[model samples]
Target: MPVEPDCIVVGGGLAGLACARELACRGRSVRLLEAAAASGGRVATDTVDGFRIDRGFQVYLDAYPEGRRQLDLDALKLGRFEPGALVAEGRRLRRVTDPWRRPLAAVRSLVDGTVGLGDALRVARLRGELLGRMEAGGIDPDRPVAADERTTRAALEARGFSTRFIARFFEPFFGGVFLERGLDTAETVFEFTFAMFALGSACLPAGGMAAIPRQLASGLPADVVEVGTPVAAVEPVATVERGAVRLADGQRRACRAVVVATDRRAAERLLPPGSLPATDAGVTRGDKGARMVAFAAERSPIGGPTLLVSADRAGPIDNLTVPSDVVAGYAPAGAALIYASVRPDWAGDDAAAAADVLRQARGWFGSHVEQWRPLATLRIGHALPDESPAARRWRPTGPRLAPGLFICGDHVTSGSINGALVGGHRAAAAVDAELASG
Candidate 1:
């Protein structure tokens, strides 16, 4: 192939893949450049002795409107978690389920005071409202819909949930999702997430989260995506008023269109001279980082693929998940996968952190935790974007920086697979429009 092409897509995560795939489908010659050894970015999985461990605890909510449009859920062969979660309150674990799906669990939840009868009734009303909102494009397709402008903590309080429920449930549960314990994440995000939970199951691809991007890449032409190739900068492509992707190794490939589908830092560097997209909050503030340390047990301790949330919030451990429960092929024969999100404060020293986490795991899973072997300690620096009120509301107007330069990725939209796919589509559409106009 020549050093020049119609378009060049940088970064091999969801957004890059989306841009490349869409451009190709539009009959434009495209080249996808990825710095990593493989695609998927944060949506990656690592295998240890036959057990597939996701980069961190992640799930695919079938309710994401963009995801439903961009992916073939049936082809992914997804495995789902049960409707609700097991909230650990002191020594007892309370079953919290959607009353619409599990009537007995709902009754038990009310009886156990996990949620008061009035609060339960109010939550049901809230669910009905969310359902109606979802019917209008999965609720808040562009911005927050709630009339209240307070934080999640304040909103829950004003809504009349018991103080005990707030401490034991909302704090720890939303903390895992936002990576922030106080629920300071924009109320818009909280409302969107709550609506998603009511709409569908929290699931994973049978192979792993990595399977998501791999599947996306699989549908494209084999030669389109080039992994292990790091792009140093995006410059002019000769005298054609286009792009030249300068690789770290000093090689340059010219193309008519260039999409920098990487992170914010990279986007800033790659954008044409004097082009900036207002420096969005998700770019400046950055998202929270998570440290995950998992343990492999001879037998599953949590019983089935149930997720156990630490209502007490006693230690660095916040939640526990058994991935192999839903996807039997995830673990080696007879071995079960157990993982937890250890607070970043505890991740100062690996050996010390692993020992500390193990000591606390025993309290939750009994003496059996002692027998669970340490699997891996993984830290994702930019796991999810800082979803502040401004960040969630931000979306790209178009993919062009100059006539031929463009940008996309989670940073360009919301910080999720949904956000990335949307970004990709936006870039592709822009490129198609620009080429046709010229």
Candidate 2:
């Protein structure tokens, strides 16, 4: 008879893969099960007609501490975006570059009224403050909510940013990031994200976001992670001091411990009832949804890799970018790949959303927009966990749920690539300690 594995990791997403890698490194045998035909969970990509389309608009911040430690950055062949954004102001686009990075562009922004001198000074001060925080032990994923902590919008207002600046710049820029336009995400998350952008570049891997999970799984043994295997439930065998995971197909796999590294909803379903408290089980009131529509164009709209954010609230499109401008491989030879992010409210009807996006694109890119062919429309319901103040108040749940059952995911930490990796590492350490004590 074959020997059972030391641990079985449920969900082969980044968190699960990271957990399995850590366990294997500690000399424990691990088996990871994933329901999809491939891993990566929400961070997936599809190739259609020579255009690479990520499930939703996503980026890899090179400054993520866990990412720096876990991933081989150079191996992914990252394509970087310019340090600032192009704001759509009225009938024209205004270039806004980081003053610290590009003084010439910053001066031009001031001259063109993209940002007032006062706001420009405030930006410098904000950048310095965030960078200082990063240097001073970095942002803690599990930090308690400070008494003065407020919503992103409130925080910006407290920092003395004008209402016009908030709406013209911060709203559309971060609206796409948090998948919500209310700017209700926690202030800590906003600070952390700002620090990351200040410290490093926001990039896309040559092979799309899927390259991240693929690189993580590459270090593990071939038989360790099994895609297309859905885990039905996790049952603890107290008498034997072990656990068994039942698969959707009725097969049972026994292991010393089990790690539920799925998303918030899936994790709640797989674990036993009452295993998690109401706070942890319902940490996020609801998941944030997002939509992205990609079109194949013969020429680039912006002619560069900088992001274009719409300041107009009347339009459905929030932001636009040409992936091919950053990485040639994203589109076939001589073709440009345009990705337009639609407002969450507009994501319901694909046909309507695409039509509205095209209408708006025509305003920005002129009549040439008519020649752009639609490539794909991706509507992601669970694009990110809620990061509102109420949700963030609850600290991340500990990894251990029972003697042999544990859980880890982005929901258990802050919502980001770094948070998922941190959760995985923490869970692996907890499991290793429990097994060692026994």
Candidate 3:
């Protein structure tokens, strides 16, 4: 029989790995299992032709409060994008600065003859109203709390945001992130992400996007890791004598408790009928977006200033960033890396879709594009757990479904990287508490 450890963590992404690390740190023997050849999940990166390319444009806002406390960021060298944004609207490039530093930029933007003062003022007023609602507890921070269910475009139009501002800013900027336009998403997501933006701008790691999980994995005590050992099934009601996990390769390991930290879809397969809250929880993907496309060039196309282009209010391509300037090692000397991402319709063609996006990009950067070349691409689906209205309702109270079973993942309230860490810590603490009570 294979040696049974104190705990068995069923995934190796940020949440699973964090659970394993936390358990090990507490002197509990742990067996961390990963389905992929390596760890990190969507946190992907690649290097080729002497340039580094992340799976997508992953910028860590300095304001993500949880990121600061959980991960030892110093160990992973980081970088940042420029402060302001260059918006491409109707034959002219408009600049939008951070509301704090460039109060003038906002004022000037109102008068720049783009959206006109009336539309701009309407947007500002709507923003204030949304913030006010949030402060009043009208918005639920934990769930998909939309003031109403309408397309983002309809919501903005209802609030009096002009077509120009929607096309220039919302479609290209937030659209790229959420993978939608017409902004029909739940209002709560907009509030959360917008709050993050206001807290601080985006940032990148010097090495690559992989550096984050890589760093987290590195800190774990070596004695606990188990690579290439895929967990076949988890029997939450198993006897301590029989062990908690039943492996596919005819292996059995016993543990005091278990953390099911796989993705929501996969977790649904592994968990019992009543284990999860609902296959679809609070948020639903009303629409989908295209895969992310990254490229490392002999030189970066992004100039000293970051350029963002939105073709129209419902534009597909949202924003663009050049990370080489922020991080020294992203490209070879005197060269830089450019990351471009777009949101294609659910049934959009891949190559054709990419080409259409590229055409739009050429309109802005033109000849400067010669030096840059294509890199890796990534598409994240159901990033937030699929929580649709029709799904049944069920919420697990504590770590154990039975006496020695537990679950953890972004699906559980803590969705972001920080949330994953917190979930892992909570699971471990729950196990500790149960053991103490015994």
Candidate 4:
């Protein structure tokens, strides 16, 4: 508290922590301030009755090129969910597995017409194309997913995929990934994510998603990162009166430079109008948020480490999973845990939505759903940056807000853990350059 650092990082999420750490490594004094009781922003976990419930359903993808540079996968000890999902039909569920991984289940799905052979083949074809594009730097996040502005549906149709395939599979599967249906997000996001899956398995750390940021922070000095330290404002140009950060308690902390790494709304609130170079363009704020309800079950309902996709898409529930199936110690003695999610924007009122979800889930597991107990609900208001055509076309202009001010977050880049880490390092590089020039 007594030392005046060269850089002050606001919002102790992955981006901010990464920025602070990088600046410290460069031999510049650094201080990271987090408003919340803990870091990780949206990447948080809750321990309820011995079960760890993550904030919404999030996966630590090992394939994120940027994240791989920042984290050691082997040290995290990740657990994987099966390659494919169980698509839900009228009232029953059909198991669809990756042909390359689970040949028998893929063949069975083809035989049962659960997933048309043409569609299955198309999925495989797209996988190859994306992986190739990613390796060759053709589908970089810097490059828009689509060549021009168009709906994801249009892109899929142009690629020759049928409407049935898009409605049934892409909606629940990727929609769950994007958290919005009708391909409202950029097709490029879908493409990059697909390539990621093709390249690496979807995984969770042995501890939980929170371990991600904790690991990043653990390497830094203890006093450098401060949790529960809310920042109320930032000075545009450092002055004797206004130094680096204006604390919520009316105290000012002076620093040679300041990097604000917070969400869209917080960034808008903290900085002066039009100070954010990356967000000044058509960056979109998602109107929808993902609601995750964790349940304690008597046993595994789906019976495997696979996500159950809702083909109907009419019900409140989008998909369900048993975390216990993916990793051990998720439940108490002789019990299991189930994670259910719904797009609340589609689902009706709160009571109606919960009722509809439980009822529809009953359709899948029969009366056994009644035995499941509702435990926790995590609602992430700003889950994703709306990747519209204009938004997708966005590229970083520079990383300077003023002589010594900077900004970084998912909003500044691709909108993922990878984007955050990449953006953080980018900000650090800018800070290093400016400080050196001085």
Query: Best by TM-score, which number?
Result: 2
TM-score of each predicted structure versus truth:
0.91, 0.95, 0.83, 0.93
- Error (Å) of candidate 4 at residue 351 is 4.0
* Comparison by TM-score, 2 against 4, better one: 2
Off by over 4 Å in 3: 114-164, 182-185, 238-243, 279-290, 305-316, 346-348, 378-384, 387-402
Give candidate 3's error at residue 339 in angstroms.
1.7
On residues 1-438, what C-alpha lDDT tens digit does candidate 3 reach at each position? Answer: 137677788888877777777777777777788877788765767787667777656566665555676677766776666655777764357787664556877778667665577776775676576667655756443433333444456666777777766776777776665555545444545665666666566777878878888877887877566667777778756434433776668677677677787876677677656666543455443324246666666666656536465554333455667777678878888777776666545344556545555666776778666555666656756454422222212334445666667877765533356556666777777766665675
lDDT of each: 0.78, 0.86, 0.64, 0.80
- Residues forming the 10-long window of minimal summed lDDT in candidate 1: 140-149
Please, what are the lDDT tens digits per residue for candidate 4 over residues 1-438? Answer: 448887899999999988988888888888999999998887887889988798888887788898888887888878888898888877988887778888998889889887887888788888788888898987755432444766666678888888888888888888888777768666776778888877877888878788899899997888998888999989877454324789998988888788989986798799866685454444555545788778888899987778888877568787888888887766776788888887645647554555677888998889999998888766677787766656655533546677888888877766788878987888999988988888
**lDDT per residue (tens digit) for residues 1-438 in model 2:** 136888899998899999999998998888999999998888888999999999998889999989999899999999999988998866678888888888999999899888998898898999998888778976675455665568999999999999999998898888778888889988888988888888888899999889999999998988898999999988855545578899999998898899999998898888887666666565557899888899999999889999998887667888899989887689999999999999765534887888888887788789989989998988888988888888766544588888988888888887888888888888899999988897
3 or 4, greater by TM-score: 4
Error of 2 at 56 (Å): 0.6
TM-score winner between 2 and 3, please give it. 2
Relative to the unseen true structure, what is the C-alpha lDDT of residue 325 in candidate 3, on a scale of 0 to 100? 69
Q: Model 4: which residue pairs collide?
A: 145-188
Q: What value does the lDDT take at residue 398 in candidate 4?
A: 49
Q: Per-residue lDDT of 1-438 in model 1, one digit per residue for the tens?
A: 345778889998999998888888898888999999998777999999889999999888888888898899998898888877887655567777889888898898888777888878878887897788778765553433233456777778878887877777777777777777777677656777888888888888988899999988997887898899999888853445666888999998888888889987677776555565465444446668888888898988777766777765556777778888877778988989888877644445666667877777776667888888888988788787766654544444556777788888876666667778988888899988988887
For model 1, the stretches where C-alpha displacement exceeds 4 angstroms are 1-3, 141-150, 236-240, 278-284, 344-348, 390-398
